[model samples]
Target: MNAPTGKELEQARSSAQENHRALHRRISRLSDDAIDLILRDARSHYAWKDQPIADSVLHELYDITINGPTSMNTLPARFVFVKTPEGKARLAKSLKPQNVPKMMGAPVTAIIAHDMDFWKELPFLFPHEDRRHLFDGNPEYCADTAYRNGTLQGAYFMIAARALGLDVGAMSGFSNAIVDEEFFAGTTLKSNFLCNIGYADETALFQKLPRFPFDKVCSFA
Candidate 1:
């Protein structure tokens, strides 16, 4: 797809700002359809249409999701978009049997991971102070923080994809060891999960399952 024109970008920014204000000011609740598009009625799709997503849209998805919060803005998440047959073949060896077809059918699958040495970039991402020293010698702390923030970023990725008119199917049933060997051989990164992205095949959707009520999962502190 072609890049958005300057005028189009400005219009999109203005519309987004207006929507943000409206949402915060309670001028209007999100339309039910809009809510359904992103959350209320979203589903974990197992089947996908043959349509391909544009590179520009994939870039936009990352641009939007990168703004999500992280501890000390550590921003540990790293993504590998596996789209080609060769890439999918490499990933296939790591996937569970039931997840194989889903990954192979989708147009793209994201290998979401975290950099264990994320603190090395603190000088740039968290420039206020020398926070690198905090995790310099602490392997346990670094691992925990990387995994936690990386997983959060993966959630942001799914949300961003949904907002941009795509469907998502996130799964954890993969062999981390094989994936790491195949993809992160020389890097300090470790796999957290995999998420498939594409247009959904609505006819293949399973029935929506029930969710826990607020009273059952929340507390009045």
Candidate 2:
């Protein structure tokens, strides 16, 4: 597909803002199917059908996810889509025994990582002040910020994919060190987690797990 023109981009942004305002008015909620597709009925898939995710879908997923909010707009999340056989092989070296088959079978496995030097872009992302200096020599602060925002982005990614009719299986059962060495070598990026994406096999899914009620997990101030 052709890249969107400046006018098209502006139009899309305007449309999105209109939708955002509509949501706040309580005049409407998303259609049941749409809600199910993205949340209530979505499951953490472990098995996939023999279908492939298109490159365009991956691009669109990122486009949608990048719009999600980040702390100080420090969008530190980076993704490496492992779709090819060679790419999967490289990823397999870091997978745990229980996760190996799942990774090998999925159409794509995304290596969600965070850039340690993301604050360097604060001049453009946070522009109002010179925020980059805050992390210039503070390794601990930079690491904490990167991991925090990067994990949020990873969740955004999964939501975006589900909204686009894809299933997601997010896993943390792997070696971050091995993934960083294999995929992020020579870069300041460090692995956060892995997610398998594709069409899920409904028959292969386990029973739905229960969640805590709102009152049990929350408190009013």
Candidate 3:
């Protein structure tokens, strides 16, 4: 990679400084209304335009995604990008009827998978202790770690897409076994979810769905 130019560094510094306060603020201090705005702004987009996501843009997306939280920074998530017609066709076989139409229409589908062998890399990730020892021979613990952290990483991928001004539709109505066997053959990585990504088709958006209020979902000591 080439060295960063003065102009690029300056731009990065300016952008960093502008969001410094918000970036450093604690999550607990954020009001429910503000949190709602952030969550609402990160909503999935159903329909998409005919444009294609460039390879360079995909790289940026991955770069941003790896920074999300994970248990002991295990970093178990692995992504499979379906941009070819053949790949999409294979993935389509696993999708439920309701998800097929929207997914098939999108430009790309990201298959988020979890690496069962992620513990092997825990030494590099959590160097303070040999956390790998916690997972060795403990199949149930390993499985739970992969599934939970993989799901969290998948959410980060969606937010990264949103941060980059791209629209996303994350769907869970799909077959995990079929997806795993077909796409991740011989690998420990297993499918978590499918996220369709592209520019939004605003005309196809349905009415906003209702959500439960805080009082019913929270309690104070």
Candidate 4:
């Protein structure tokens, strides 16, 4: 588990390039059914089955989530899995009234948050370049990078959960100030959104909503 040195790093990079070349030659793609499972068919669940999620599952979810890319590899997102009745009760105070029951029904609700001081880890995360000092004394840069990348990670969370046969209901209707005060006090972490994860109560699911067509939302340019 030692860190790769100069020669080792070069070899790794070459191996990666070779792998990418192989992939390009093959042009592997996800099956349409697999796509449906992760994005098309997946619905934002509102109710969950009584089954409980284990700590190991949460750990596995996080392990998959961090593998998704981030700005300068900052990896700003932090999570708080609220699963206990007491924790859920506390979290309920920060959510909109309508969302409280949805969160409660799910066995685990993840508080997806970002750290304003995440730049401190840049030196380690983005080791190829010394990016650690780039955000120093810059509130705007810190806030923007953390939020943008953290939100991307949040999206990855839902997709990864679906791939793992878990239902997800993500929302931003919570009071950020309240959640921060209650769950992230004395820390630099700021709440981005909440995602409830568990097996869905399919009978309680609503019809999937429509999305903007590719033509309407995109352009050839």
Tens digit per residue, CA lDDT, model 1, 110-192: 99999999999988887656788899999999999999999999999998999999999998999999999999999899999
Best first by TM-score, ranked: 4, 2, 1, 3
TM per candidate comes to 0.87, 0.88, 0.83, 0.93
- lDDT (CA) for every model shown? 0.94, 0.92, 0.86, 0.90
Better of 2 and 4 by TM-score: 4
Evaluate model 1: give its TM-score: 0.87
TM-score of candidate 4 versus the correct structure, residues matched by position: 0.93
Model 2 lDDT per residue over 104-179, tens place: 8999999999999999888778755667878999999999999999999999999999999899999999999999
Best by the TM-score measure: 4
Would you list the clashing residue pairs of candidate 3?
Answer: none
Per-residue lDDT of candidate 4, residues 13-128 (tens digit): 99999998999788778889889999988888898899998889889999999999997898999999999999999999998999999998899999999999999976678767
List candidate 2 segments past 4 Å from native.
Answer: 1-28
- Candidate 2, which ten residues in sequence have the lowest lDDT sum? 1-10
